[model samples]
Target chain A: MRGRGKKYWLEEIIFIGPAVLFFSLIVLIPFFIGMTYSFTTWNGVNDEITFVGFSNFLSIFKDEGFIDSFCFTAKFTVVSVTLSNIIGLSLAILLTRRLKISKPLRTVFFIPNVISGLLLGFIWQFIFTKGFGAIGSLTQIPFFKLSWLGTESTAFWALIIVTLWQTSGYLMVIYISGIINVPTELKEAAQIDGANHRQYFRHIMIPMIMPSVTVCLFLAISWAFKMFDLNYSLTKGGPYNSTKSIALDIYIEAFQINRYGTGAAKAFIFFVVVALITFIQVRITKRKEVEA
Target chain B: MIRILKNHRRIALEIVALLLALICLSPFYFVIVNSFKSYKEILIDPASLPVKWILDNYINTWKELRFPAVFANSLIITICSNLGIIIISSMAAYRLLRVKTKLNKAIFGIFVMAMVIPFQSIMIPLVRVMSSLNLNTSNIGLIICYFGFGVSFPVFLYHGFMKSIPISIEEAAIVDGCTSLGVFFKMVMPLLKPMTATVIILNTLWIWNDFLLPSLMLHSRELYTIPLAMNGFFAKYTKQWDLALAGLVLSIAPMIILFLSLQKNIINGIVSGSVKG
Candidate 1:
């Protein structure tokens, strides 16, 4: 037993020590330190700082653009998450069907996901600004001539469209796995019991894929909340700061405006809001899973 | 017969899928075709292929973006970071699996928890820590940062998958007079090839394409990764659409080639990782 104890301790040092050290130094310690900085005024360049308590948070609460960014992020999250899941699941269903060319089809659809979001955004920017401009001229459509990332309403929708286009293929991959894993016999029995396609979909498919739905929804929400590359590349928060999501706002505060403490505050608030929403979602979904 | 209608339905679905493909492919069309056009021509007729078939943009962009150095920097960073992550995370996971004590459980908890906390909350503090350590701007420092940030999730993946591996394999090696290290390197490590592939692919793709971390860590122009270099091009030449598009395409070419080549493995890794989690 003494020898076994020695062996275990030695193994622990060899295996787990580096990881714990790295994670502590890089992630855990920094996280708490950044949280502390949110309560202080640190411009990231100068060393002088004083703890001002909740004033940063209070100021953020009062800032109109901060509020607008928050609302835009929330709306973006909802719209993108819903559409991404719906489109993804539909594609997943189609791809998982017993078709000969499903393999190549899935590959083609998922190609965009492998590319960087920044590039994807840039590509879509070109498409909207140039290709759509040509189409607008040829067709003489008034709406197409208007700037995509310049207007508030159109900018918000443009962000959503770009996000959905890039991400749905990814979520579709996830849902395809989910759909394929559903008990085939259960689905077969439902089909055999004189149920039509719609009935089978409503009764068997949705419930069976609920776990995947939960996962995809959670991922989409997190992604949309933290979305930056696309927003940065396509709009850079726009002609009048219309497309600024919370992440972009935090980025501008830190990198552009050099307001590290304010960015930290915004990040902290963003964390709290996301954590609350995700926690609530998990509880609800877990309960549903248990009951089902 | 119902067979004819089924054929019609299939054809209709194929058409719809084709339209979707056109939509997906048009962006690439814009980037590639526009890269060859003169700026005035691009502005005048952005949808068409280049009228002049100009190679000047590629030549000019290659020069202006400092292609050779930045590409080397990106490759070096991605490779070093991936290597560090694979080494440290694998060792850590191996130990966690072997040592099933209370400490290990707590460590596991920490790793799983790290998966959910958004990077934004921690990024500023991470930068602060790097600065305090005097590690900012050095490639080594950036490598350390990448390893530090990347180790948690890969370790989590390795730990979970390693649990399913039977203990008897390691025990057999030990009974054959192998030391723990020997047994790990000779027997246990090779068996983890699949998970290793998954880790390598996922981490490589991320580290290769990462923008924010490199942007923050590397103020020195010499250390600029692809994304950072690409963005630099954007900032430097805002109105030079031809050169910018050319650089953008060049920046993403490595990843694009990688995706096309190992697409099967990548898709497998993503699906397995996501579903298992």
Candidate 2:
């Protein structure tokens, strides 16, 4: 072979030794530890632990707020992913056209993303509370001016609008890159075949940018699932605890209520759900990419 | 006639794009313009550009928010965390790519596995580890934690892009009596500039904007990062909208300026990073 196999083994050990140890200590070890803790009733602070197997997972089904949060997170993910792709892809197409102002427009659109999620939530909180009031008074629209984030129904939509506002620009940049990479020859060929704009987009453009769509959906779903700061800043899961996401629920369980076992169980459940969805998504999308 | 119709469609798209852009930017405009107005004026006329410009809110909020102190804290945390991340990630990436053996492959697999394991999965034990090590509630401890967490993705980014890089250069350098470390630093590091830029931009924005980790690990007031510091103003009773908005504007301004300067790279970085990662 290339050299003595033992030498190669030694070299490999020398090289990968640190990364393995680091990841184990930092990531893998902690993950398993968290899984173990899920089976125990370890009140986050005290070291006293009682072994309770599967009861934590069992309790999740009975927890009404957990169910609501799961449903809310799912609904949020679907709507956010769909809207983000549509708006983002549309903006990407428009901005990549032969327009002079597209450059500045792209920058303006992306400004909110540079700021922290907490900051965006706070900023939108201001607009929803104060700025929405102003728009309502000026335009005299009833729902437009109402306390958008006060009630459950309105608070959810308010969160949706703000999330879209903050994130669509980032996704747009991604779509822009994907669109730009589509072969010009293929596009021109479609044009020559007498395909109209809608037909070309439906057939050629959509399939070609399927990779970007996968990536966008993956990000949008995970972000929606992990969404906490916005809910925290805007409503603090308030006005009868309407906007509580899983991440927020975990935080509340851990910090607010100090229920470590329940929080750990909740967190484990969160991980499993997100992991399953993401695994399926990546597999399906990767398969599509390979097929295409 | 066909050309005219195409032109009309293009114009319509442009108008729609412009309206969407306005919707995207209006809130930002509101935040900036209202930061200069008095609280009473803002409450009375939130939409209007300040009728009489007043700098007092900015001045007062600047001091009350402890802008300079918190700015220093954020700078220290970001700089240290970023440096730690770059070092650990680059070394790990170099080692993973260069050393091709069963053990290395297994280690690399472990690193990839780290990518999907959400932070929520590990936070409970992580906190326990931190407190046990007396690493909680301090800036240094937080930076180390960030390094361990942040390195996985950057390493992945570097590893993927590194595959496309030819090994002959490194071989030649080794033949020239360069050590592995020297070869990586002298040859591979320079070649990795684009990916480095991507990593830097992504991680900088992440570190600067991160709230939850800092809020959890850091309990001390003086060590509070910008996000946590702004959150200090938000109480269960009596939320300060004016001060909060003003603080938000202040915290976002530096990064906005930075982002504006590096707009093209930011776009490229995000695209390549996510696409590859």
Candidate 3:
């Protein structure tokens, strides 16, 4: 019995050891270390570290750049989340209907999602700068002629546009699944009760798809809040750092400016905010989800 | 008469949806057509077809970006990371499911909580940790980092999946004198194909297109992945749209092909993955 117990332990170790080792070394340890680093005045280069307590956190409140980025990220998240979900839900509805070109259209919409954000940003950069210019000249449309990336407001909208273009298709897939799961009998019953298209959408379809709405909202919030790559390649937070996201700001702070302590502090706060928001959002949405 | 009217409305909606799809695809049109146009021709009329198709841009950007090398680097990292994630997470998940010990439960809880902590939170110290462990700037280091960060989600997926699998099969294998490892490799892993496919599809898309972690880890030109290389290329040739567009096209081509070929699986994978989460 003793020998058998030992053998079982050995088998367990063989199966579970590598994952624990990697996960601890990579994620678990660093997370704690980063929390420690957040309290120190470590410049990321020198060995000497000074423990500064919460002053690093305190200074972020006074830092205009940080505040600007916070506001920008908050606003960006709102606009992008609202627009992407709306567009995604609309596309989901359209594609779920029995249309001849549904599959092909779905493919086209989803193609953008497959491309890397870095590449999509670059592709749109050309469209904004060059292609827009040509179209503006030929058709003489004022909307296409604006300096899309060169201005602050337009640059902000440009980021939102690219994000919507890339992510709506992904959200559409989720919404489609949700819509499909809605019972046909319920829809027929609603139809017999003379619910108009709008009434059915509001009273029945929306409630039925609440689970997907929760998922999509959670995803959109996280994606928008933690946005980095697209912002990096698209605008680089250009036009006077007006479009900078919190993630990009943290990267620039630590790497570009070598303010590791400050960056770590900012990162800690950012993590807390993201966790709290997503947690609350999930809890709220999960309550609304129906069994069907 | 009312049924005819309803049919007409449906057709109208279909046409409208088709138009919207065309609008969605317009950017690709701009990218592909302009990729083949000369700098002067592109500037002249980007909306029109290329007056003279040019191979120069593709050839030049391919050389400049070292397309083959970076492409291979991205492929290697993604494949190794996915393989590591699948093997490590599945084994760990299987054990966690079967063991039901205090330590196992605590470890699983840690992983679940770890999912909520954003990458940014650890990234600063991660850089420090990586350098201390001599992991920074090497592809192996990057792959290892991916293994760590990628484990939580897959483990979660695999854990949920393994619960549904009966323990009788493994018990039968044990009764037949098979070792635990053999039972896992031969008996269990085969049963995990569907979840494994979902895990692979999700992780492949993420790691392949991931730029931030790789960007921070790999500093050398030789270590650049496709996205990193494209960023560097664009930085250098911001004005050289002719070459930049071609690079964009080349960089996106592999993923487009993969997605198209595995469209159904990929879609199903994403849907299931998201819904489960």
User: For every candidate structure, what is the RMSD over all alpha carbons to the true structure, in angstroms?
Assistant: 2.1, 2.2, 1.6
Candidate 3 C-alpha error for residue A238, in Å? 1.5
Q: Point out where model 1 deviates above 4 Å.
A: A1-7, A141-143, A290-292
Q: Which lDDT values do the candidates have, in the order given?
A: 0.83, 0.83, 0.92
**Consecutive 10-residue window with the lowest summed lDDT within model 3 chain B:** B37-46
Looking at candidate 3, what is the lDDT of residue A11? 70
Q: Which has the greatest TM-score?
A: 3
Best by lDDT: 3
What is the per-residue lDDT of model 1 for residues A161-207, given as tens digits with 9 covering 90 to 100? 88888889889988988788778788779878988989988888788
Worst 10 residues of 1 chain A by lDDT: A283-292
Name model 2 segments beyond 4 Å from true.
A1-18, A290-292, B1-8
Q: What's chain A's TM-score in each predicted model?
A: 0.93, 0.93, 0.96
TM-scores of all predicted structures? 0.95, 0.95, 0.97
What is candidate 3's CA lDDT for residue B197? 95
Better structure of 2 and 3 per DockQ: 3
Task: Write one digit per residue (lDDT tens) for candidate 2, span A144-163.
Answer: 77778878888888889988
TM-score of 2: 0.95
Candidate 2 RMSD to the real structure: 2.2
**Residue A269 in candidate 2, Cα distance off native in Å:** 1.1
* Alpha-carbon shift of residue B187 in model 2 (angstroms): 1.0
Which clashing pairs does model 2 show? none
Candidate 2's chain A scores what TM-score? 0.93
